[model samples]
Target: MKTPVKSLISGLAPVLVLAIAALALPAAQAQTAAPAASAAPAGAKKIIRYAFRIAETSFDPAQITDLYSRTVAAGIYDAPYEWSFLAKPMQMRPATAAALPEISDDFKTFTIRIKPGIYFADDPAFKGQKRELTAEDYVYSLKRHYDPRWKSGNLYILENAKILGLSELRKKLIAEKKPFDYDTPVEGLKALDRYTFQIKLAEPAPRFISSNFTDGSFTGALAREVVEFYGDKIGEHPVGTGPYRLAQWKRSSRIVLARNPNFREVYYNETAPEGNARLQAIATKLKGQRLPMVDEVHISIIEENQPRWLAFLNEEHDLMEEMPADFAGSVIPNNQLAPIYAKRGMQMVRYPRADVAVSYFGMENPVVGGYEPHKVALRRAISLAVDVDREIRLVRRGQAIPSQGPIAPETSAYNPKLKTVMSDYSLAQAKALLDLHGYVDKNGDGWRDQPDGSPLVLQYATQPDQQSRQLIEQWNRNMKAINIKIEFSAAKWPENLKSSRAGKLMMWGVGWSGGPDSDTFLALGYGPNKGQANHARFDLPAFNKLYEQQRGMPDGPERFAVMADAARLMVAYMPYKVHVHRIFTDIAQPWVVGYHRNIFVRDFWKYVDVDLEAFSRSKGAAQ
Candidate 1:
C-alpha cells in the first residue's frame, strides 16, 4: 500500500485533545480511540464509551470484511505483527512473534518464532489447563480460511501468495470428501517445535508480511480446541491473547469488552516519525506507559446517523468518530468547530482518511463487462461523466479529495502526477465518447441506445440510507447530462456484497481501506481474484501477469513502477471509476486525554485513558 498523504487542517491542534469539558456522555450508541488516559479529575473512572453507525456483523475477521467487524476483532485477538499505535508510517512490529520472520534469500521461506509465555484468555475449552499460544496454533488458525464449510472470504490472500502446500491440501480434502485433520500437518506450513513455525511459499511472495499473512490481530493464532469447542458458533466465542476479551454482546445493539486479566503486561513505547513534530511531542507523554489505561470499553450500535449524532451532542458519548458529512457545515462550519460544540469543549480534528471510496463497474456482467469497443466505451463514458468534483463539494462537503487512481493518498504507489481520464469530469467528452461508439438516441425517448439498437439501462446496487439516496441522485443527474439511463436498486451493504460477488450487481460503489502495501489496490483488478477481491471481475491476462510480478517483488521503485503500469491499464479500461478519498473529523471531550486517530489502525482501546472525575465535575457544574 502507498504511504498516506497527510491531510493538513491548517489551524487544527497537533495534540489529539488536551481537554473537553462536558457533562458525562452515556458510554454507548454515540461513538468510540487513542492511547493512555492523561491527568484529569482525581480518581476519575478510566472508561471510554464509543459508538458506530453500522452494527458489527461478525467477530470473525476470517468471515467478514466490514470495518465494524475488524474493529471488534482488533481487541479480541492478536496478530503475529502489528502496526505501531503511534508510528505514522505504520511499521509492523512483533505481536505474538518474538521478532520479524527469518527469511531465506529467495524470500519464499519465512520462519517465525512465537514468543514463549504468551497465553490466550482462559476459556472453557481449556478444560482445566492453561491455554498457551503455540506455532501450531498459528498454522491451525491460518488453515481455518481454507475450510470449505466456513466459506472464509479471506482465503484469496493465502491462495494468491501460494503458501506451500496449503491450497493443494485444501483442494485434496475438498475433492476426497474428507474432513480437514488439524493434527495432520502440511509441509508448507509446519510447527517445527512448540515455539517455532515456518512457512514455505511456492513463489517469492514479498508482500506476505503486508498482506493478511501477518498484519492485524485477527490473523493471530487460533486454538483448534477452542474453534471445535464453539463449533459453528465460533463467531460469538473469540479466544485470543489480546489486551481485552469480549464480555457482553447483544448483537446489533451493544458490546462490552473487559480487560483481559490473563493478558501479559505490554506498554506503549512508540515514537512518531521525524517530520510529524507534533505527534512526536505527544508520544513523549505516552512513552513507557503500561497500556490498556482504560478499564472497560462500551460500544453501542446506532445505525442511523441522526440519532448517533444526537447521542454525541447529548454528551452520552466520549468520542464521536467520522461525523456525518451531510451536516458537516452545521457542526464544523468553515473548517472550524461550531460555537455550540466549541463552547461545550468539543474540538474538530481533521485527519487524513486512509481509504478510497470507489464505484466499480463489474467487468464480467453482460451489461457492463467486455473487451469490445461498445462495452469499453460505455464504461469510459460513465467514468468521465461522474462529477467527483461536485461529489467533493456537495455530497462530501469538501471532506474528501478526488481520487487520482486506484491508490489513494497516504499509501504506497500513490503518484499524485499520474494521469488518468477517469478522474476527468466532462459531460461533453462523455457524450462524444458514447457517440463515437454508436451509442445515440435511435428513438425519441431521450436516452441513448446500445450499438445493437437495444434500450440501454444500467442497474446499480445501493444502500437505502439518505446519504446513498442523495449520492444516487447525483449519479442520475450526471448520467442524465450524458443521456445515459441508469436505475438504482436498494440493498444493505451485506446483501449488495453478495450480489456483487455473485456477479449479479452491474455497478456499485464502496470504500477500500488499503493495507500497508500497493498490491491491496492492484489486486482489485487481478484476474485470479475474480469473484473474490476482484469485485469488478475484471479479467485481463496482461494485468494479472503484472500483478503477480509486483506481488513477488519487495517495496521499492522497481516494484512500484510495475504496479503503476497495472494501475495505468486499469485507468485505461475504467473497470472502476475513481471517486473520492474520504476525510473524517474525530471530536473528543475535554477530559478525554491521550487521544488521536491512527490513519490505518483500529486496535487502540488499550492505549486510550479516561478522566471520570473531570467528567463528573463538569456534569455537576452543568446540573
Candidate 2:
C-alpha cells in the first residue's frame, strides 16, 4: 500500500518535489550558536506571533467548520486522541484518554477511559472551584451536535455513523420543538464511570475513531456547566483542559492565548521516523523539554496576501503558515528557497497538503439546479467550460496539481491512476451541450438564456481579496468563451460561509481539508450531509447508498471499489468542480524552533518553541 506522502510525491514528482525539506544553511550561519537564555531577564515571557489568512467564525468546536477557527479551538480543547507531534506516516496517540480506545470485534462499540486529574482552566462557571474533566463532558459535547440550537456543521459525520438511540432522541426533540436534554442518557453514548465513556453504533464504523475522535478541534470534550452558563455566547468563552486557554479575542482582528497554569506535565518525547534528518534533528534538540515551551501566542487575521507576506518579511511575525501563491515565484523559485531568505537563515517547509479546492452549484436553485436531464446537462457543460489547468498555472502560480476527483491526494480512496472528465476543459463540447439543452441566445443577445427564455446568469459568492479577484477574472474569461453570463457576489469569508450553509447562495467556491480517514471527502455528496458539509445540497439516493456502504466495510478492495463508484457519481452529476490539490509552503524565522507542517495535526502550538533571547537580538538588529 502506498502511503499518502508517497502517493502525493508520485503524483506531483514531475512538476514539484513533495518532500518537507528544511532549507539548507551556509556553514558559517549553521555553526553560529543560538543566543543563551541568560541574555533575557528572568521570567520574561516567550511569545510566538503569526497571522491567519482568513477570519475565524467561532471557537466552539461544534459551531466552527473553517480551518482558522478549528486551529484556535484545538489549542483550547482536549480530545480523546491526537496525532503524535513528531511521528511520520502519522500515528494517533492518547490525548485525554488513558490509552487507546477499546473496540468490539464488529467495530460497532467503542469505549474510552479518560485520564484522571485533568482540570479545565479556572472559570466562573465552576463557581470558584477547580473543575476536573470527566467522561460526562465528552458525552455532553457529542450530544450538542444533535441539538438544533447549535446547528452544528459536523452533525452529519455523527449522524451518518448511526449511533444507537441518539438520532431518535434528536428527532423526538425536533418534533416536539423542545430543547435537547443532555442529562437524558442514550444507548449509543454513555458515561460508564467517572472517567470512562462508551458509544454503540447501529452499524460497524471501521474508521470512526480515527476519523472523528483524533482531532480535538472537532470532538473535544465540553463542560455542561460551561455550556448552560454561557448559553448562546459559548463560542466566545471556551474553557477546556488543554495546554492553552483563550486569554483575549478581538473577533476578526486579533486573538491571544496564555499557557494553562494547571495543565498536566507533558514532556517533549516523540519518536521521529527514521531517515528524515530534518525531523530527527528537531527531536534531538527539543527532547526532555516541557510541552508548549512558549508562554503566549498572538494571532492576527490578515486576509490579503501582500500585507501578510510583508509582515513576515519585516520580522513582525515569527512564522508564515501558508505562503501566498501570488509570491511563490519570488519566495521559493523552482521549489528551492531564494537566496534573499536563505541568507537570513529563514527556514521553509513545503508539502502537498491533503485538500481540494472546488466550485459547487446549489442543487436547489431554480436556474442551475434540478435532477432533470437538461439541468444535469447544463451543470456538466459549465464544468467542462472551466479551464482548471489555466487557473492553476496563472492564478495559483503553478503551486497546485489539477484534482481529478473529490478525493484529495493524501487519502486511501485517492487513486493516482484515475482520470475523469472533472478536470477536462473543452469549450466546443460545452457549447454543444448547452445548445442541445436549449440554452441559446434566443433574443439575439450575446449571452445565452435559459430553456424558458429567461436570463441564465450564474451568481457566484466570493470574497473581496486579491486572490478571489484573480479567480473571478478567470471565471469571467472562461464563461465568456462559451457565451454564458455570470456575476459575482462579494462578501467576507464568514458571511459567505453563513450564506452557503443556509443554502442561500447560488454557487460558491471553497476548500475542504481531509483528516486521517478517507470518508470525509465523500461526505460532501452524502444526502444526510446536505446543509452541513454538502454545500451543494445534492440529494442523490444512489450516491448516498454508496457512501453508507463504504463506511461500514474495512480497508480493503471492497471499500475501495465502493468509494470509486461514489466518486464517479459525483463526477457524472457535475454538482462540484474539484479544481486542484494545493501544495503549501510555510516559512519560519531563525528564532522560531521546532516548527513543522503536519497535515493531520492542527493542535501544533503545543509542540513548538521560541528562542526568546534570539528573538530579542533579532528585534534589536532590525532596529
Candidate 3:
C-alpha cells in the first residue's frame, strides 16, 4: 500500500533533494550516447502531453467510476498505498502512510500511522494557514461515503466493508431523519491521535487491504474543510497532497496539472530486479533519478481513432495508447514493430490487460431480464447465438484471448479450464433452444417472435465508436443466424453509463478490471450491487450467498472453489456475454523515457520524463 512507500520517501527526504548520481550501465547493457543537441532541454521546462480516449466527467473520487476519471483523480490524490514502482509480480508499498497497518484482534482491528509535515496544496479552506495532513482527514474522507448525500458509486464497498460501527451509523441517520452528523464520531473509524488512525471491522478480513483499500480511487485522502468550502462544487476544485495539482480544466476539452511546489521530495527507489535483459536496459538509464521529473502535464480527449493516430504520428501527442484495432495488423505486423515507427525510434509496449470486456443483458428488462421458463430459454438461446470466437478473432484483430469467465487472466483465481456456457460457436444448438421455447416467425417476417405472437426485438445501447460498431456487427451477424432482429441505441459513453446504472437500458456492453481480488470479480453479480456494479441487475439469492462466502475467505483452494462455483452460476444465468481479455498497446516517441505499463496503475505521467533536447528537436523539425 502507499504507506510503505510513504515511509521510504519520508526516511529518504535528506538525500532526495540532492542531485541524482548518474546511472551507469556496464558495456553489455549500456545505452548509446544521444545526439548532443537532443540530450537535454535548451532552457525551457519540460511538459508531457497525452490524450484520453474519452473525456472524464468528474474529479471527485467518490463519484468517479469510469477508468478515465479514475486516471484523472489518481494524479490529484494519493492512495494510502501505491503499487511498488518496479517490483515484479506486483507488490504494494505505502504511498502516504507511515508504515503498513498494524493488525490486532485476529485481523478485525487495523491501526495506521502517518508521518508528520505533509501538507495539502494551497487552498483557501486553510484560512491562510498551512493545512497539515493528519489521521483525522482519512477518517472523515472514509465516512463521507455513508453521508447519504454524496451518492457515491463506491458506497456498496464501504457499506459492506464490515466496518464495525459505520454501517450502523448510516442506519441510525436514516431512522432519525437527520442529516449525517459528520461531527458525531463513529467509534469504528476513529483517529486515535493526531497521527494514528484506527479501524475496527466486524470480521477477520486479511485480504481486504489489497482489495478495497488499495483501489486508488477508494483510498485518496480528502479534507473536510475543503469539501465544505466547495460544497456542491467540490469536484470543480480538488486539493490534495499528491505530486500534482489540478491547474486548469475545460470540461470535455482539456485538463492541465502542474507540479505541486509543496510536494514531498522523493526519488525513484524501487525493488531492484535481476536477470531480465529488457528491464536491465531500462534500469541502466533511470535507477537513481528523482521522481516527478516533468514540470506540467496536458491531457486532452480524442475519441476517434484516425485523428488520434495521426496526432501521435505528427509528434503532437507524446504517447499513443491503444493502437486502433483496425490498424493493429498494420502497426505491429506479425507481432513485430513496423519499420516506419522503428526508423523514428518509437517504442511499442504491449501487455495483457487486467480486465475483461463484456456485454450485459438487463436482467430486469422484459425483453431480456426475466425468470420465467420461456424468458430463461430466450436468454440462453441468445447467449449461445453470440459467436464470441469471431469477436476475438476479427474485432480484436487477434490482440486478445477468449475469456473463460469474469475473472481476468491477471488474477490468481482465474481458472483457464472452467467451462463457460455459450462461449463456443453453436448456431444449431441456439436454434434448438429457441425452437423448443416456441420462438418462430408468426407472420413470416423472417425473424423470431415471442411465443405469444409478439415481435421480439432487442434494443441495445452502444457508444458511437468504430470499435463498438465492429463488435455490434459481429453480434448482429451471429443473431442473424437465428433470425433475431436487434437495433442500436447510440449515445456518448457517459450517457450510456448513466442509463445502465439506472437500469434503463435493455442491453449494454462495457469492460471491468477487478485487480488482484476475485471478490470484486464475483461481487458484480451480488444482489445488493444492482444499479451499481450489477449493471445486469441480476439478483439471485443463491449467487449472493456464494459471493459473501468467497468475500469472507482469503485466497486459497477453498476460495477458488467458491469462485469457480460463482463463475459457473453466472455462465448459466447468461446475463453477460464476456468475450475477450485484451492485450492493450501503447507507442511513445523516443523522447519519452522510462515508459512502462503496470497492469494496475494507469496514471504515470510523473514517473516519466521528457528528454527535452530530443523532444525540442522533433517539434522544431515538424514545423
Best by lDDT: 2
In TM-score terms, which candidate is top? 2
lDDT of 3 at 417: 72
TM-score of 2: 0.93
Which stretch of 10 consecutive residues in model 2 shows the poorest summed lDDT?
A: 1-10
Error of 2 at 479 (Å): 0.6
Is candidate 1 or 3 superior in lDDT? Answer: 1
Per-residue CA lDDT of candidate 3, range 1-623, in tens?
A: 11000000011121221211111112111223332234454567778877777887777777777777777778777767777655677787777788887878477788888888888888888898888889988888888888887878888876666897888888898999999887787777899999889888887777767666555566788899999999978878888888889999998889999988877777766554777666556666776777688889888887777667667766678888877655666678776777656766789988887677778889999888887778888888888888777776677777888776777787878876766674666789889989999898999989999999999999988877777777778878878899999999889888888888899999888887766666766667888988777888989888888888877776799988988888888887877877778777889988998887776775687777888877765554443
Candidate 2: global Cα-lDDT? Answer: 0.84
Alpha carbon lDDT of each predicted model:
0.77, 0.84, 0.76
Each prediction's TM-score versus the true structure: 0.92, 0.93, 0.91
- Cα lDDT tens digits for candidate 1, 226-321: 888998888898888888889999998999998888888788787787887656776787777777888778899876666666676666788888
Runs off by more than 4 Å, candidate 2: 1-38
> What value does the lDDT take at residue 358 in candidate 1?
80
